[model samples]
Target: MTYSGAVKVGGAADVHELADLMISKVAVGPMNNNAYLLRCRATGEQLLVDAANEAETLLSLIGDDGIASVVTTHRHGDHWEALRAVVDATGARTYAGRHDAEGIPVATDVLVDDGDTVTVGRVTLTARHLVGHTPGSIALIYDDPHGHPHVFTGDCLFPGGVGNTWGDPEAFARLLGDVETKLFDTLPDETWVYPGHGNDTSLGAERPHLAEWRERGW
Candidate 1:
């Protein structure tokens, strides 16, 4: 899976690049939807993954490199309520699949499908369709400069549970199975897992929970 326009960071700025994808978590709702800003150390370009409900905090924290684009893992408002304001402030385009992209409260400037690549500096993200919670939920998978894979799982698979499947339970089940078999299966167990919300975890910690997940005990 590859998404186009991973976002090229502009060079020659005084910006202190966020080395190794500096992770920041801001509690954005009663439910605590976590928003992330992945900035390229080399280029200073940032990718806004799952903009939470507070546009002011996200904008200020996102910093001056200027958000190249915003991406939504799923269509949940908690994950993207601030997108409209973020887009207005940063003038960054929003990326998602055509069907669900429009649900982000702003125009989705770019449409991505499975295997499309979205590039940010040297990071290339491939969008994988992990439909379950929504009709067109996607997972962004890419390898960093260290070659360690990073998955920006937006509600598809959390540390202990998966996203709710209001649209289709069967599809949600398939999504769960697909995540276990497809995305997680392709990477090493030590790969970093960046979910839409929650503290960062590793594949090592999360993989073993699949059985419990399937059994609804996690």
Candidate 2:
């Protein structure tokens, strides 16, 4: 389906393009986790984010576009439920953050840390480690040549506030600080945010209320 730049959820959404990259999202699993298929329009080389649940659906979404790599945002089960199946089927390279790589069911081909790059065809994504939801939770930043940057944040930052802190004071502090310094402080307000589950938002929308999120301690 054509997206016309509007945000969509569930089923097969619009294929959003930024510069040379094309991104398609489908919500899968019982938790409604989002699995994204990112393709470099220049070369058709692809990348899959999360591989979260629903192997069949994920595979269908992948179809003939064979992926070059799959990046697991964190170690959460819901995020990688289809990881093994997708990897086994496609023989794609797997990457995860160094601190949380051990928990993933599949052996990681590359252990990604802060500042690492994951390329899809002609497009490149920079990895930013966000430490709260999981010890090694990572958010990828894609600098679009034609527009503002786009970030794929797996359960770290959302539309209204940060991901669930589970009420840990230190964890909350780390998450808040990392998000503010690494993400909010660096990226532009127009940056598009794609989360692990459900919907999407912009850094501009979530920027003004950083204090409120901290004060509420969520």
Candidate 3:
């Protein structure tokens, strides 16, 4: 229930730490949704991503420091199972992609669009709206002071290729094109990728397979 160690899809756990921020993740629910807790080291302000499941465990992880806000990656059911509970408990503001906000069961406080920034004390995360997986699917980009960018991709992207497009060719094309321009071309190879489920990967590791993924078209 608690975040005991780093979580991997099939390999070793990967942990990421930056100058003034710390990211801790736990895989929850039957779908193995990955929920993240980001804390500002200097201000102790925190942010939670997904709130996928296990409210008690998440609350414990949050503890007394409390949370500034909760950002839902997409409209998927697995991603917001614990959202209402966490929001009620912490009174933290809720943010979601504008187009996808209505899809979620709970109300969203702030409707974030592309380029919007969410701040937790000194830490700031830029919201990038990556469409296709859903009309408003989004990824959060954090430029770590230590080095490269860290992206919370949700289901829009992953290690081997882009997230499932559910056999929709048009959707696949949109997602792929956006990913290449918004993520691949823009971010460096060292950018870290954290998805809604499964292990983490880097832009460097997946960069080489772009053509292959494009050819395969998933």
Candidate 4:
């Protein structure tokens, strides 16, 4: 089946295949957080993004191949609900944004910053720090040599708008500015967006609504 990027808790994950990477996206926990399991086709090395919840489910997905690292995109509780369990079970090194490392319960083996690279086998993904949703929320960028770029955006972005700022205008502006400058302005329209929650969208589909999102001040 074609990968639609729409998943639900207790359902099978949706898998997207690339030349060198396989991305499996599943929704877990009550918050319906999206957890991504990335596998490098060349070496079978794996990396998991946001071990949100349902440790058993995650472990089942991991199977015997195991993962080298578990990257928590932000410090939000919902995003790392199963971090400890997953790490303990897989013995994977933990990675989180530098500024938000202290907030996450699990000890961060690596503190990632904007422009830092995380490797899964021979494939490398660049981290892009997007503030506002959280002090240290980050989005991972995978530039596929044979296809469009793919971005795993944590709570910093969603299909309809940026993450909620709880009515804080300053926070909203900061997030919007960062998203516009670092994401929309820099990435091509075909970039695929896998958000922390809900269905996926592309930069091209969202670019036309930038001014509208800013005006709404979400």
Against the true structure, whose TM-score is highest? 4
In candidate 2, which residue ranges exceed 4 Å CA deviation? 1-10
**Top model number, lDDT:** 4
Candidates 1 and 4, the one with greater lDDT: 4
Sorted on TM-score, best first, the list reads 4, 2, 3, 1
The collision pairs in model 4 are: none
| Per-residue lDDT of candidate 2, residues 1-218 (tens digit) | 44533333345655786668889888785897888899988899989999988898888889886788999999989999999999999999999999999999899999999999999988989999999989999999999988899999999998888888799989999999999999999999999899987678899989999999999998
Model 1 Cα lDDT, one tens digit per residue, 60-173: 778776789888877778878888888888999789865687676677888888778887665677888776777678888766666577787888877667777665658667
lDDT head-to-head 1 vs 3, winner: 3
The digit string of per-residue lDDT tens for model 4 on 1-218 reads 89999999999999999999999999997999999999999999999999998999998998898999999999999999999999999999999999999999999999999999999999999999988999999899999999999999999888888998899999999999999999999999999999999899999999999999999899
Q: Give, for candidate 3, the lowest lDDT window spanning 10 residues.
A: 8-17
lDDT of 2: 0.89
Angstrom error of the Cα, residue 198, model 1: value is: 1.9
lDDT of 3 at 194: 87
**Candidate 3: C-alpha lDDT:** 0.87
What is the C-alpha lDDT profile of model 3 across 1-218, one tens digit per residue?
43233574333223356788888887776787888899998999999989988887778778898899999999999999999999999999999999999999999999999999998889899999998899998899998877899899999998799988898989999999989999999999999888888878889999999999889989
C-alpha TM-scores of all predictions: 0.83, 0.95, 0.93, 0.99
- Candidate lDDT scores, in order, read 0.71, 0.89, 0.87, 0.94
Error of 3 at 147 (Å): 1.0
